[model samples]
Target: VREEAISRSRCFLNSAMAFTLYTYPNNYRAIKSLIAAEYTGLEIVVPDEFKFPGDVRSEAFKAKSPVQKVPVLETPDGCLFESNAILRHVARYRPEANLYGGPFYEQGLVDQWLDFSAFELEPPRNVWLYPILGYMKYDKRAAGKARNDVEKALTVLEDHLLLRTFIVGERITLADIALGSALIAPFEKVFDAKFREKFTNVTRWFTTLINQPEWKAIVPSVSLCEKEQIPAFPKKKEKQPKQQKQKQQKSQAKKADDESAPPPKKKEKNPLDLLPKSEMDLDTTKRTFSNNPFPAALKIFYDAWDPEGFCLYTSSYNYNSENTVDYQTSNLVSGWLQRLDSLRKYAFGCVNVWGVEDSKGPFVINAAWVFRGPSVPFEFTDCPDSEYHQLASVDLKDEAQKAKFEALLGGAEKYDGQPLYERKQFK
Candidate 1:
């Protein structure tokens, strides 16, 4: 019966379906989906004059998505919106490939990180990079705020890349794809030589990722230029006070130390350890479960328990009992999990599980919990499970929560002694 169903549903490659990517060349979100499609081996059709505010409101584009967003993937399956969602769909059809990953848990991780890229990193970068570079009209106050925000975000990334080659698991995944696309704007316009030099790890990771064959296929080459000389501020006519000079030197030394300090070690217990021990308490009331645990429950927990100071959105795809896992999906998932780890310093609290599967007979996940911290991002498994009940305890900078979490899971020694992921904290 499974074979028959698979045969019936097989999608034959006809003339590559018209996938209209409605975007300007410089739009970060648009480029992300476009590049993802390219890496996944999907053909993309770019439309002329479909740029910015014009494309966002065009009636022709609105037919694809009510909001008229760029990167609306028009497939034989029908129109899909959201750049990340579009990338997922395009990649899903080619699961055998390594671009995504090999397991259901991995795919979930990819989805999670892609959501992070859209939520946590892109907004401020766009605010500063776009206007500053002439991609859009400039707003001085907004641009300044954006620059500050981006610097903080970049610091987090800088710390994470210090230990790993890629964002997730072991190789490039959707996490890298999404982040690379988001970074394109700033790397090209706002992050000049000095800025890149300051974030050494980020510079190294980005340089390697973008140079990969897959990335180069879609993203245009970014020009790296020598630092331009800035005119010196006119010297004050009066001599500077000796006290002020000393203070300035002290401040500069402190800044250097702050940038060079290693990330804090992960504490043993975290707030997630406080949840009720019963499995029943973790299960979702809304979904029916088979005798076995449902896969969606894991997703609910991961999505909800995002301590990583970032919001996570669930994917539209329903968890299926018969779903086949592949390397591409797994890669994407792993990338997301790694990205989540990288942001752990900014997260707090535990995520809870609701259920998994749909109402017919199998169980489905419905609810979750997330704890956030002022400066940390959330953390999760590098490789997740589509089946089996799993719970993760993450610390987003709360010592008490970390202690509790460690107690629940035996001891801090059992888990990686170091914070699973480390990122720079910006004051």
Candidate 2:
């Protein structure tokens, strides 16, 4: 009797409380609320004639959103701003959907992931995507950083999804919807084949979620990224006379090209090849490190070490407080190592994470590196995680610093009083 009463009440609410989602068409953030409505069987009226900047900028719409952003949900009693908030509101109209989850604890977990999506994923996602979509001016440096951040955020998700189908419990929750919508633009626009391959679990989970009947009703279609789209500058309008002249010049250039083949381009040599040969045999040392015990490897490294030709350095992650899971922390170090593949011949090191997952962590990541040149190589410094690293030159003369180097490289049981979680080598 209670179940039937609840169903009838839901039907009444669905028929009575129609919402107006005021937003421009095809906004990814707005899609979250719409998807939630689909699950809850709520009638959300999206104004077809809604003018984007024009309508949203009006004084009438001001009450709906303070910043006059699209995706403001107008309820019977009041208005709600912020896409995530609107999503939660729509999810509440029907209690049977389990969009926010059934249990109180499950609902709290949903909120946790929603916050994660908003903070960790959305900001960097916007920074990386908006420029490509022509919503914002392109900054190469900023875009690069944003791309790295997105990958790191995805790495966290990738690790989390490895053991489960959904983010929260058995069923799809608001957390999945929030994070999934956040990822849509990225997956379709920037996450290319090679990049997507690294996060198989994330890819599988995302593919499953977006293809659902509810999600498809809102999104319509999604195409996974094939080629990465680089930030492009809009072409300036050319004068008619200039265009005609350019066509003639292009004809002449083409004729010239047909007349003769261009000379073959020369391959550029690596900068490291120009350096003076050093006595340190990196290959042998790497082999020693692999084949022998830590003590023997350290002895071999010390014997062959050339301070003038080679440089030793230490790098520690600046944001260790954000690392909560074991595999996630390990994945972070793994990603850094993968990005440094071009420097494999010129560099070697072991990166260690301290502390266990979930208990006393957020983990600590620190590493020691030996570079071919007297200074740190640009290749190592240009990796995705480089900005987060606190890099320093390791002075072997200092007994303490030398001990620290050995400890990191040898994968000591503990680092700075914390237990060593794992060590990943970049040989």
Positional deviation of 39 in candidate 2, in angstroms?
0.8
Model 1, span 166-193: residue lDDT tens: 7777877778888887887567655778
The runs of at least 3 residues in candidate 1 whose Cα sits more than 4 Å from the true structure, single-residue gaps closed, are: 1-16, 49-58, 135-140, 225-427
lDDT of 1 at 128: 59
Q: List the candidates' TM-scores in order.
A: 0.48, 0.55
The local distance difference test score of model 2 is: 0.83
lDDT of 1 at 350: 26
Query: Distance from true position, residue 370, model 2, in Å?
Result: 54
Candidate 2 lDDT tens digits, 1-427: 5346446755876778678889887787898889888787777899888898777657788767765666889999899987888998888877677888878999999999998997678767887888788765566666787788788989999999999999999989899999998889889988999999999999999999998998999987899999988778779987579779999999999998888877789998888878998898887878889899898888888988898789998888866755655655665677677777889989888889999654537689998888898898888878755766878888988988888888888648898788888887889
What is the lDDT for 280 in model 2? Answer: 88
lDDT of each: 0.53, 0.83
Model 2: residue 63 alpha-carbon error in angstroms: 2.7
